[model samples]
Target chain A: MKLLEERIRQEGLILSAAVLKVDSFLNHQVDTQLALEIGREFGRLFADQRITKVLTIEASGIQFAMAAGIALNVPFVYAKKKKAVTLTEQVYSASVHSFTRQETYQVSISQQYLGPDDKVLIVDDFLATGAALIGLVDIVNESGAELAGVGCVIEKSFQEGRGLLEQKGVRVHSLARIASMSPGEIHFVDDPSPAYLVKEML
Target chain B: MKLLEERIRQEGLILSAAVLKVDSFLNHQVDTQLALEIGREFGRLFADQRITKVLTIEASGIQFAMAAGIALNVPFVYAKKKKAVTLTEQVYSASVHSFTRQETYQVSISQQYLGPDDKVLIVDDFLATGAALIGLVDIVNESGAELAGVGCVIEKSFQEGRGLLEQKGVRVHSLARIASMSPGEIHFVDDPSPAYLVKEML
Candidate 1:
């Protein structure tokens, strides 16, 4: 997490109070080594759970989810942003509104890939409005799968994302939790609890 | 490549003469280990190219591009399907027509990530009509970056993807080259020139 925070400070561009652009190394263009390290961090955090699969939305979240899947040695499923011609089966879906794109789109996963037998860990690049992550959680719940937890690489703690997921009793962990940010400065929440980490056995 | 071929034989659903769905393992629900191996295969093939970066389109191509980036120990960039608010700067953009979706969309990458100094290896999950891959190739060319070649996980050789790319004088390598497929039956084109591999001198 320290490394991630440092990288954010060095390379992350703060466009505004609400916008942090990590396109240099996180989402648009990625540092593969850093991504692998982020995955290891997620694996360590959720090591207690018997995670059967990693789930995420398409495009941005795919790399982190794939990295987590490698770390956990499990398959990762990404919900499609659109129902393509080949996706001709019953699906578990949730409608999500994207504040960035200013649109509502349906995210879906085939019923054949997930069900009651699976234990799901949801992962994504950023946690902001919580709209997208919440949609994934709803899909997991609808599939009758057990929700292990949610893991995010960068989190906007000032936003309502963490609060909403915690309200659903979903365990959440973020590598870099931005407390506040402006064009020239940024702050990260150095929470003592690190509540997302599963407690060790006595 | 044999491992990949076997996976397709066992899990791929042949919907028609053209559509072969491997979502259960390749795209939607991804097998992490297999993906890693595929990346290693690509790395081995393109070892001679001094590839500074790997590039692909968003969604389906992220994992494979991530995998290739890992194998090559280089960063990867995925072109955005739409221009989000954060992508406010000047960008290298292309229009790609999706045969399956029956629509054309603009794919763009931040100008900050790519330029003349970088050597890039383009990667993707599938090479069908080569529409998306060609768009990426054009983006790379527009950036003034040197392209090593294009690497695809699966190729429908019966289609014009290879021919189109070849016409551009672009080197193409696919792990599994399918000659044709009909329901339960599939054939592979075993080419003598596996040109991607770097030759060794005694």
Candidate 2:
């Protein structure tokens, strides 16, 4: 977690009062070695819980989820952003609005993958408004699977996503939680509490 | 490679004589254990090369690329299918057509990641049309980086992708090259060449 925090400070760029760009290391160009360390940290955090599978949404979340899965020795299942012709099976679907893209898209998981006995740990690169995480939780519920917890690489705690997930009784753990981001400056909260860890950043 | 071949024979499904579905283990639902093995295999295959970075496209390709990156102890970079707010820097862009999605999309890579001094290995889950691989290669060329080779989990030899790549003098290694496929049977090329030996079947 400290490694991730240090990396964010060193490479993360503040675009404005609201945006922090981690393209250098987290999202665009990945530090795979660092991701493995982050994954091991998450594995250590969730070692007590029985995590059957790690789930995440497509694109950015896939790499981090795969890292955690590898460290935990569990399978990782990613919800597709779009439905392709090959995806013919019935799916557990949810509509998610991307604040960045400024549009709504459907996120889905093949019904064949998630089962009633599975305990799902949702992972992602960042948690902004929590719209994506909410959608993932919806998909997990639709599959009749139990929600183990949520693991995130970086979380914007000032946002409302954490509150939304907490209201639904989901445990959230983030490696680095930003308390606030201003012009060229970023602050982090060291508390690991699920509630403040996700929603109190602003 | 043998594990991948066995997995395909046991869990892979052939659909309508056209589609090969390994959704249970490869793309949709990823088996981390299997991917760990794959990462080790790819690392071994490219051990002699000075691989500064592992390059791959987002979504499906991220998992295998991460696996190989971890195995090889290098950073991995994934190209975005679309531009997001998170991606604000100048990038090398290319047009790619998705065979399964039936649409053409632009793939972009941050210019910050690829450089003339970097030696990159392009990786993917499958090779059918080779359009994605070509686009990745184009980006690599645009950045003036040397491409060590292309690595694929599965390659459909019946398709023209491999030949096209080979014609361009890009060495391609596939874990499993399907010589041919039918409604009920999937045939793997029994003997792997020197180039194929580096490739494994997954």
Candidate 3:
């Protein structure tokens, strides 16, 4: 997580108080090694849960979900985003409003993938508005699948995403949880393990 | 590749002569171990190229690109699809017509990730019409990057995608090449690695 926070500090581009662009290494352009490490961290965090599958909403969340799936040795299901007004198939669906893109889309997964027999771990690249994550949680609940919780790569903690998920009793783990960020300076959550590790150094 | 071919033979749903859905394993729901094998296969095939990066279009291509990136130990970049008619900022853009979706969308990648110094291996889930892959190829060439080749998980060999890439002097390698398919039956190209492997087993 500290490594992720350092990468955010070094390479993350803060466009505004509410917008951050990690296109250089996280989303559009990806660092495979770093992604793998992030997966391992998620695996370590949720290793005890007996996760059966990893779930995510595409296109940004696919890589991290794939990574988490690899770490946990489980298959991953990426819910497809559709603009259609009607559900054509036997699928669990939820509507998500994107704060950045300024649009609401439907996210759905085939009924064949999840059921009462499955335990799911939801993963994503960012947790900002929490709209999309909440949508995924709703789908998971509707599918009769057990939710293992949510794992995020980077989180803008200032946003209400975490608070909303907590309200749903969703266990959340973000590798880099940003406490606050402005144009030039960014601060991570104070209790990050890196800070504790720093104090141990002689 | 043999493993992939067997998976397709067992699980692939053939909707019509022109459509085959492996969503249960390849795209929608991904088998992590199989995907890693695919990455390894791609890595082995293109290993001699000294690829500096792996490239693919977003959503479906992200997972394969991630896997290939892991196998090659290099970063990967996924182009974003946009509906905008005009270009904004500095980006390499290409217009692609999707036969299935019956719509044309623009695929764009930031100018920062690719350059003349980069050797790129274009990766994708399926090589059907080649519309999207060609768009990616044009983006890579436009950015002054070196094209190592194109790697596809499955190729409808009957389609013209392979021929078009060959005509453009782009090397192509698809793990599973289908010769033909219908509602009841499907057949792979004659020159598949799996058949050759099966000969060795006896």
Candidate 4:
């Protein structure tokens, strides 16, 4: 987690009050070695869960989920943003609203892949509004599988995602927890701050 | 490669002569360990190339790309199907036609990640029409990067993909090459077919 935080400080670009661009090494273009380490961290964190599957949404989350799957030695399933033509079968689905994309999309997984027999660990790149992660959690619940927890590579702790998942009793872990950020300066939950997070902790 | 061929024979569903679904392992629900082996196989095949980067399109190709990146001890980059809100910079892009989806989409990679100094190995889950792979190949060319070759998890050898790639003077390697398949029967190029393959070779 510290290494991830270090990468975030060194390479992460703070675009605005909310947008953090890690395209250099995380989502868009990836550091495969770093991704593997992140996976190992997730594996260590959730080592006792007896996870049968690792789940995620398509595109961004696929790498982390696959990494987690590699670490956990389990199969990873990605819920497609749209039903592909070949996916002609019963499916478990949930709708997710993307604040960034400014649109809604349905995420689905084939029913044959997950059921009561599976224990799931959902993973993703960013946890902000919690919309997409919540949708995945709903799908996991719908599958009648035991939900172990959710793992995120980078988390916007200021956002409502963690709070919402906590409300659902979902154990959540994020590698980099950003406390606050702007164009030039950034604060992490782990950063020693004369900032609000420390005051909030008080 | 034999293990991959065996998995295809045992679990791959022949939805049609053209559509063989290996969603249970390769794409949707990925067997992380097998995917790792596939990556290692790609690494072995392209070992002589001294690849500096591994590339693929997002969603499906990511797992294999990351796996290859792992085996080769390098980074991987995925082209985005759409320019996301966060991706405001210039990019190298190419348009692709999806036969199955009956649609066309632009795939783009940031201009920062690839360049003349990098040697790329493009990896993907399928080589059917070769449309997407060709798009990626063009992107690599546009970036002034050196493309070592392309590695595919499975190849529908009966399709035009291999021919088109060969026509472009690009090297192609596929773990399992299906000579032909139908509802119940699947034949690999490696299969001792009383089929067209042996005769064509003769």
Candidate 5:
């Protein structure tokens, strides 16, 4: 987390008060070593839970989900943004609205992949507006699976995302929690003793 | 490679002569250990290339690209299928026609991530029509990067993808090369001594 926050400070571009671009290393162009470290952090944080599967949306979240899957030694499922030609079976789906794109799209996963026997841990690249994450949680609930919690690589704490997830009683953890940001400056929430590091030391 | 071949025969659904679905393990619901093995196989195949980076398209390719990046110990850059709000800078773009989706979309990569000094290896889940792979090759050429080769998890040998890539004088390697497939049967090209395996034993 300290390493991730440092990388954000060094390379993250604050386009505006609401926009933080980490394309240099996080999403567009990825740092494989850093991604692996992030996965280990997630694994340590959720070590107490018996996670059967890791879930995420397509495109951006795939890498992190894959990393978490590697760390947890479990399979990861990505919900497709649209139904492709090959996906002909019955699916569990939820409609999500993207504030950045200003469009709503249906996210779906095959019914066979998740059911009452599964324990799901949802992961993603960013947590802002909480629209997509909430959609995933709904799908997890619809599939009759037990929801372990949500994990995010970077979180915009100033937004309503954390509040909304907390309202639903979903345990949420993010590596880098941005307290505030401007055109040329950014701030992160201070944590003197992080839980993952404490666990690592023990 | 034997493990991958076995997985396909056991789990892959031959939807039609043209479509073989491995979503249960390769793409949608991914088996992390298998993916890591696939990556290690790619690493063994391209170990001599000194690849500076790995490249692929968004969504599905991220997992394989990440795997390859891990095996190669290099970063990866996934070209965005569409221009997002945060991607405000100049990019190298290409248009790709998807035979399955029956539509053409623009794929773009940031100018900052690639250059002439980089040796890029492109990885993907499938190499069927080669439309998407061709688009990525063009982007790599435009970026002035030296392409080591293109690696695919599965290749439909009956398709025109290999022919097209070969015509461009690009090296192509696939773990499981299917000669043909139908409702309940699949055939693979027999290779008694794979080149990568020979290199590994040496």
Candidate 6:
């Protein structure tokens, strides 16, 4: 987590008041070594849980989920944004509103991929408005799968993401929590909670 | 390679003449254990190349690329299929036509990710028409990166994918090469090459 926070500080580009571009290492281009480290850490944190599968949304979240799957030695399934022709008509679909894109798009997972017997952990690159995460939880619920928890590389705590998930009683773990950010500086909130302690350690 | 062949025969679903659905273990729901084995095989095969980075296209290719990255201890970069707010204006973009989807889409990689000093090994789930593979190759070329080769989980050799890639002078290593397939039966191509034989020994 420290390494991730450090990388964010060193390589993460703050594009605006609400956007942080991590194309150098996180989303567009992946730092696989760091991803594995983060994955192993998540595996350690959720070792007690019965994680049958790791679920996430497509594009950025796939990398982190893949890394966690490797560390936990569990299969990872990602919901696709675009409906491919191979996907069947019977699917677990949810609409997610992208704040950046300013558009709502449907994310879906085939019913055949998930089942009632599975215990799933959701993973993603960033937690902003928590729309994508909510969509993932919806898909998981549709499959009758148990939602173990949610894991994210970075979470902007100043946003409504954490509060929304907390309202639903979903346990959220983010490697780095940004309380506030401006230009080249980022501030962290001081707390003894697990998420805060993780940030403090970072 | 035998493990992969056996997996295809046992678990892969031939939905129709055009679609071979391996969603149970490959695309939709990934088998981390098998992915790790496939990763190790790729590592062993491309071990001599000294690959600097593993290049792939999102979101299906991320898992296999991550597994290979873990085995090789190298970073992996996946091309983004859509233009996000975080991406820069200047990028190496290429059009990829999806046979499954019956549509053409743009796949782009940032210039910062690939460069002349980097040796990129392209990884993907399936090599059907080789459109995605060639798109990746174009991105790598635009960045002036060295192409180590291409690796695929399954190759439909009868589909002209291998021949197209070969025409581009890119060496491709497929775990399971299918000569042909149908709803009733699937025929696998004989591994006449030494590399495939070595992969089988693994």
True contacts kept of each: 0.94, 0.91, 0.79, 0.90, 0.91, 0.88
Q: Candidates' DockQ values?
A: 0.76, 0.76, 0.51, 0.80, 0.79, 0.70
Which consecutive 10 residues in model 3 chain A have the weakest lDDT in total?
A193-202
lDDT of each: 0.90, 0.85, 0.86, 0.89, 0.90, 0.84
Least accurate stretch of 10 residues (summed lDDT) in model 5 chain B? B193-202
| TM-score against native, each model | 0.94, 0.93, 0.92, 0.95, 0.94, 0.92
- The per-residue C-alpha lDDT of model 2 at residue B55 equals 96
Model 1 alpha-carbon miss at residue A46, Å: 0.5
- Which digits, one per residue and each the tens of the lDDT, describe model 2 over residues B158-177? 88899988998898999998
Task: Give me the runs in candidate 4 sitting further than 4 Å from their true place.
Answer: A194-202, B194-202
lDDT of 2 by residue, A1-202 (tens): 8788878777777776668788878887888888888788878888888888999999889888887887788999999988855677889999999887789999998998998999888999898899999999999998899998999999899988888899999999999988887755677888433221121222
lDDT of 3 by residue, A1-202 (tens): 8788777777776666777778778888899999989999999999999999999998889989999999999999999996322123488989899777678888888888889999999999999889999999999999889999999999999999999999999999999888877666677896543321111101
Q: Name the top DockQ candidate.
A: 4
Q: Write the per-residue lDDT of candidate 5 for residues B53-163, one digit (tens) a residue.
A: 999998888999999999999999999997978888889999999999999999999988999999999999999999999999999999999999999999999999999
Question: Which CAPRI tier for candidate 3?
Answer: medium
Give the runs in model 2 whose Cα sits over 4 Å from its true position: A191-202, B191-202
lDDT of 5 at A27: 96
State the lDDT of candidate 6 residue by residue for B1-202, as single tens digits: 9999878877776666557778778888788889889999999989999899999998889888988887888989888888988885588999999877778999988787789999989999999899999999888888999998999999988898889889989999999998776674677888543221111100
**Model 3 CA deviation exceeding 4 Å by range:** A83-89, A191-202, B83-89, B191-202
DockQ of 4: 0.80
List residue ranges in candidate 6 displaced over 4 A.
Answer: A190-202, B191-202
Instruction: Single out the weakest 10-residue window by summed lDDT for candidate 1 chain A.
Output: A193-202
TM-score: model 2 vs. ground truth? 0.93
Error of 3 at B86 (Å): 17
TM-scores computed on chain B for all candidates = 0.93, 0.93, 0.91, 0.94, 0.93, 0.92
- What is the Å distance of residue A161 in model 2 from its true position? 0.9
lDDT of 1 by residue, A1-202 (tens): 9999878877777778899888878999999999999999999999889999999998889999999999999999999998867787899999999998789999999998999999999999999999999999999999999999999999999999999999999999999998887676778898433222121111
Best by TM-score: 4
